[model samples]
Target: MENKTKKNAVVLLSGGLDSATCLAIAKSQGFDCYCLSLDYHQRHIAELHAAKNVANVMGAAAHKTANLDLSLFGGSALTDDAIAVPESETAGIPITYVPARNTIMLSLALAWAEVLKSQDIFIGVNALDYSGYPDCRGEYVKAFQAMANLATKSAVEGHAITIHAPLIDMTKAQIVTLGTELGVDYAMTVSCYQADSHGEACGLCDSCRLRREGFAAAGLADPTRYKKHV
Candidate 1:
């Protein structure tokens, strides 16, 4: 049964499959979802467009885009034009890992959550089948939650904040299955690290590979539109 009073939640939406699923999960838990997307000057601005579409389609109470020039720092491939995004699998954390990206995004989400008087913040950071980002790990989420509780005025006043990562331990296939069960339109979500202006995926990047494999494993047809290569 649904709760009579729906609690508000701030969801960090990236317009990707995982984040979309995360938002669906939050709504399922009876939270009034407020979707948050960041325009941090990444190569694929297409996902930001996807974010808006997803938020509307998923019935979010409100959606907001925060603009910032993370490209000014330019330490990673996504934000730096100098570094190239690798099409093939690479060892270690990969060049596509934005430095402290999840931390920064969560900080923004925390601020919004405090202002909205929402104690729950949901992020879609998966540890499995991901590009090996350090910030996506379980420990990182726990540490961030700890910091958020201590740093926020709401927490100090006995309204503790919780950071929810529903997909943290789930495999890509599992996430896909869950999202499908929740009626998420996978076609509207873009997981590509280098999507074209039209939001068509490259279908050769690490993110694309993972997404493809996930659908295959889930026995679901991939609905992603791919760009044609010469």
Candidate 2:
């Protein structure tokens, strides 16, 4: 751990519940957090706004946003405007999966972490109760960490950085519970792919369903605005 008396980390804050919760977790760990959000041409800019709010509320040491046009390589619903965000059964890997999103985001965060001389980067990726995004898995994150260490000067100099996924194994309900204990305001975060103009969550989408069910399982009140109570 290299005697981290000045422990600092870069957090990938998507302004969603998980990411926001991750930010809180990082803070709780006594890390001076630097939050990074991306504008990857997703359907909703609302999430970006929520990210900003979360960063400010959580008291990030620094908050930065990057504008990357993933739509330029459009294939997923998040980038391709032609495809609608699905609300059906997620049989396999959903179409909404943006190719290499976590990879790209982590790459950028790695660069920032090196520049900041931070020892860790926190991401909100989860494997349980999540759409089948491969990058969210523990193996993928581990591989990325190794790659990051090998690819950067910091790692080459024996400053082995870590990619922290505090929510990797947690279900959404457990996540919600942790966030609630951390005094996180779920209403301030947006998790819906199809959020309305007013920032209300579309209760029919996979994300919405998972979020609602998680809250139900945790016996917590979801403060998010839903299009309908399913």
Candidate 3:
């Protein structure tokens, strides 16, 4: 039987492969997903467009883009024009790691969830086969969830907020397989760190490499548009 009283969930949709798959998972769990996209004034706006497309096609109850210029701080490669996004893998956390990005995005999502009286917030932060961001770790997510429950009025009144990181443990290939099974249109998602205005990937950045590898590992043809194609 179809769930008559669908619970609301706030999903942080980044228009990336992981986030798109996360949204699909939330929908599969019978939540009326409210997609949230952050316009942090990153190097590219292509992912924002992809986010909108994913939200619409995936049947999100609502989609909202929050505007905050993280570029003003200028710390990470994604936000700072001075820092170049590396095409090759490097040791330690890459410069592409935005400072406290996940924390900031989740805080925004938490606020929206409170207003909507939604107890769930979904973030697509993978650990395995990832770019080695500190915030994407399981412990960080758990800590944030604890803080959220303590800080929110809803949680104080007995409605505890749950932070869902469904993709945290899944490998890139596993995520690809799962998303495929869930009917996700991978082409609509953009995971490139240096995507062009038209959303064509550079096909050399860390993100593009991972995404391509994932599809290959899953024995699926990558549908991502590369700069070569343009």
User: Could you give the C-alpha RMSD of every candidate to the true structure, in order shown?
Assistant: 1.2, 1.9, 1.4
Clashing pairs in 1: none
TM-scores, in order shown? 0.98, 0.96, 0.97
Question: What does candidate 3 score on TM?
Answer: 0.97
lDDT of 1 by residue, 1-230 (tens): 46679999999999999999999999999999999999999997999999999999999999999998899999888999889889999999899999888999999999999999999999999999899999999999999999999999999999999999999999999999999999999999999988999999998889999999999999999999999551
Cα misplacement distance, residue 203 of candidate 3 (Å): 0.6
Question: 1 or 3: which has the higher lDDT?
Answer: 3
Tens-place lDDT digits, model 3, residues 7-124: 9999999999999999999999999999999999999999999999999999999999999999989889999988999989999999999998899999999999999999999999
Sorted on lDDT, best first, the list reads 3, 1, 2
Worst 10 contiguous positions by lDDT, candidate 3: 1-10
**How many residue pairs clash in each candidate at the backbone level?**
0, 0, 0
**Candidate 2: regions farther than 4 A off:** 1-4
Candidate 2 local Cα displacement, residue 63, angstroms? 0.7
Best by lDDT: 3
| Regions of model 3 farther than 4 Å from truth | 1-4
lDDT of 2 by residue, 168-197 (tens): 999999999999999899999999998977
Per the 3 Å backbone cut-off, how many clashing residue pairs does candidate 2 have?
0
